[model samples]
Target chain A: MGELVVDELEVQKYQEQEVEENGLPLVLLYGPLSLLNVFGSESLLNNFRLIKPWESPEIPLHEYLITHAKNVKALVCLGKTELDSKAIHCLPSLEIVVTCAAGLNHIDLIECRRRGIMVCNAGNAYTIDGADYAVGLLLDVLRRVTSGDRYVRSRMWPLKGEYRLGSKLRGKRVGIVGLGSIGSEVVKRLVPFGCKISYNSRKKKPGVPYPYYSSVYDLAVNNDVLVLLCSLSEETFHCIDKDVLTALGKDGVIINIGRGPLVDEEQLVRFLVNGDIAGAGLDVFEDEPAVPRELMELDNVVLSPHKAVFTPESFIELQELIVGNLQAFFSKKPLLSLYKNALSASS
Target chain B: MGELVVDELEVQKYQEQEVEENGLPLVLLYGPLSLLNVFGSESLLNNFRLIKPWESPEIPLHEYLITHAKNVKALVCLGKTELDSKAIHCLPSLEIVVTCAAGLNHIDLIECRRRGIMVCNAGNAYTIDGADYAVGLLLDVLRRVTSGDRYVRSRMWPLKGEYRLGSKLRGKRVGIVGLGSIGSEVVKRLVPFGCKISYNSRKKKPGVPYPYYSSVYDLAVNNDVLVLLCSLSEETFHCIDKDVLTALGKDGVIINIGRGPLVDEEQLVRFLVNGDIAGAGLDVFEDEPAVPRELMELDNVVLSPHKAVFTPESFIELQELIVGNLQAFFSKKPLLSLYKNALSASS
Candidate 1:
């Protein structure tokens, strides 16, 4: 193995030789895309044989998974890959799944729980970065940061006289839709900006100083800006619908750093067009990489391509956490970001 | 005055009759534009006779000022109008100059002090708004909020795939220049975002927890982001010069919400062009209504047309302060936003 040379020839040869070469346990890289290329996945290469099925586009993913299932004891998934029951069934020897993202909606927790497979996510590693992004989006929308940039870039300021004034962020009533890690972080950040913060979570939190509304509609009714940072669950899906948007009213804005399905895109577009809602700063869409064309043209709204949780700093942190979880799982000590609630349920 | 009916007819009539009609003390409204329309300047109209030179464009400004200079006890000046020594000479009877802005650099404080003419600026009225804007601009630049918005708007996201990753705001070293009200406000705002904040003010602030650098160059050298929120003066003009920008390095961003001359705009443009500095968010420029055309093409820079202090909420606060200052001057009370150092120096 001569220090495991990562040459192109060796990389190609390893694809044909799918066994646990050089006494390294196999860790299947499930998807074609991963941020592992960032640090070159050096940490993983040192400890395990990584079989990336998606690297060979000619091979069917299921066929590739089955071929290496006997030796594959772990799997690492990226953003877009689906790890459902069928895929889980393919990797029968897999004992742990590491998702390199804050959200685990793409992973089937029920299937993992039934099979006693521990799942670890990039946990609080992204909390501060995600919260920072949400605040940035809110400020951009309310202060017209992006639109002002466009106006300046278009050589329109000298021609257009003055750009329109945007609403102030300070002292605006802000309702955070969820009070989880990211949402809590948003509250902490907004407090110093002088925003009147309130929130709506699934259940009342005991010690939170913020006034809690029982429902999202009530939260919207009372606040000027509704920040959607809640997880997308069966019960939380499409949480920000026409009714919530209507309650938010004409001068209100929505900032969605949560899943796209949390907001009803059709209703949101209609509201923005008719001036029923003032503006929105959206980082996600129902179908990613495909934003509504209507949103693109609107000067009031700011659009980002689902990049809320990504930053070089956060990516570096995530890579560390992912490696830590993998090492912990292989050593059987404990997974660092293990979804412990599901683990407890199955135990 | 027939109950001082504020009709369209009377508004036109007031332009023709610029004297202290109905025994109201005259307040000369300098320049053509004012945000007076926002709240209708009811506060001013209720207390004083308003004289606007630019209202009747046919009447030359010099001619108009000469006509009403005797009774122009207070002059309300907006952005474009230069209330220089000549303007002070024009308004011979001027007792107080109420500038509708936070910065008093526009007014000749020296001349005003020598002449026993008290000056009142927007004061802390713009403190929070300016700070909010500074934060918005910093976030926009660092997180690529404005550029991301541009990418989405230009219909390039689908073609370009993922936009370039932006530097994270959290845990980065941020240095604020000028620890005045706006600067202090920025410090307060940035603290919660997990930044290690430092500042370079004229002197060390009493009991400030953050480390203090005595010079702008040192502050720039030590920080990842430099926020310009200080007053522009002879001592501080072009404070952020080529050396400061270079010390800030390739990943550092500069956010300017203070007066434009506070930073060397030409050097800033050069640094941004060459990627010597990562980015900048500028709200003010050395020349008003004239930005470097070179800057219009850069994605790394976000330009705002001196709009940091223009929100309706802030404007309303400013109007109240202006009216209060005028009334205070007439009543021989302390001016609301008096440039007190000059007052104390001259008293």
Candidate 2:
């Protein structure tokens, strides 16, 4: 009674039997478990046993899944991990796959549906954070805040001549592409700067206070600063190309917080070099973790490592939301689901 | 009209003669005049002869007085330039000396009186511009906007773990060391951030909405951010010492836009290194044009050259105001002067 102990193997066997009888779910955490600093909460962790890939470094994905497949129910993963049919076949008991990110192109929705699995993504998770970053980038680039800092850091005091002259953001015109969650949030923060806000979306958002442009080129032409906040789809791919950049004119600044593929990188470099655009602030890149040296050479651009939603506060919030979604799904309650049409019809 | 070919020097001489005979008595231009892009504006030019050092770089002070002294009633200058008995004696025709800056430290008021010359300094020229730069510096420092920019430019993508976490200015307590012209302006700008404002001045102004702290130490203790907007003089020099910095505590961030000499540089460096103070945004340093390399090594500080009021708009406004003050002095009308106390007593 004072120090009661149970056989470890017997306890493990009993737990496995209970899981097999109740259809226990498997959740594979593929990326850094330091994300636990983000997603770890007593209520959130109680729902599932997290399988961290880092802890089991040598274990191959197929072998691990096959070994643990009997009672597996779901897989929670990140961008770096690929989920395909061959890998999916190993997890015979897998039912649901959740991606804690907005983009779905990485996940094979058709293949998931064929395997009778539900796919859900975390959409608008980066909306506010991304928007804030875009605004921050805009301010940093236009004001030459970073260049001034670098100058001082290099022990080059008395930054004389044109270096001292930084552009003021007050009363400047800001054009946003795609008035989605992130785009609208960008407008909210920028309103304080007294910028005249205009935007180009697929269609106008009615009852919204800001002016809307019918065409992306028209928005670029009229705005002093053009912000890329649109979604990256077939129609919107490379929408902000040479012609759109030309429309932005010589003194105009362009900020891209959307996907890298949304912009024509070659054309952007050309425009920035030739003074077709005054400057740019980019968070997303084409083939990221591999930023172009050409962009680095230009002092006019402010680049971020696509870290719009990587704040500590945002990470915590994202984790809480993901946990809430999982809990609701398990409890047979309506989940805070994204891409409902795609999920219901196919995946 | 085609036959009337005039000599450039002759035309300049005639123009100078006309100005000496009928134009304004004083022209106090504190800032650089090249900022006024529209040089051909005859109306603006006809208002007053420029007292800018850049325009007449080769002309000695003695030569300037000798050439224009015959009909010149007064002269104009800035606080950076010294106005001693020698300057007064050389400009024998100068009845008044107007300074196009807030401080009168450079102008020898006692000597001006002995020489029977009137002195006036522009007290409000720096108010709004100083406030703008202070807020800009605060935002720049707190958000690590400049550091982020540098990271991006260096082609370094900040992965989740590598990202530098920046603090938000909202809801933070800010202590203003002096509630004077620039300090009051700083308060007005900081109001929108929803920050709690407290201040310490030699004496409190009537109807100051913010809470007043009697002592700098007390203010530093209570506030998360401390902004030095006090005037640099004997009593206030090196006011923010080791003791005050210690009082400011570990979480406090200091922003000094007022003066370099106001902060004890060595003590500040020590505090910064030991994390006694979180960070600083310095627009002025103890030895300007020679900022310490040690300060440059730290990422927690943002340094700018002494350029708080160096905007093109502010420069233009200051020039126009100075010219107006000069015009008033030459007409023998009661000057819209800064030193009315001394002037009335002298008269």
TM-score of chain A for each candidate?
0.94, 0.83
Q: Pick by lDDT: which candidate is best?
A: 1
Best by TM-score: 1
* TM value for model 2: 0.80
Classified by CAPRI criteria, candidate 1 counts as medium
lDDT for B78 in candidate 1 is: 64
Residues A227-285, model 2: lDDT tens digits: 88886778888988899989888889988888898889889989998888899888788
Q: Per-residue lDDT for A130-234 in model 1, tens only?
A: 899899999888888888877777778878677888988888999999899999999999999989999999999999998999999999999999999888889
For residues B234-322, could you state the per-residue lDDT of candidate 2 as single tens digits? 87899899999999998889999888899999999999988889899887889877787788888788877666655555556566666
- Please give the fraction of native interface contacts (Cα pairs under 8 Å between A and B) kept by each candidate: 0.77, 0.30
For model 1 chain B, give the 10-residue run with minimal summed lDDT.
B1-10
Clashes of 2: 1
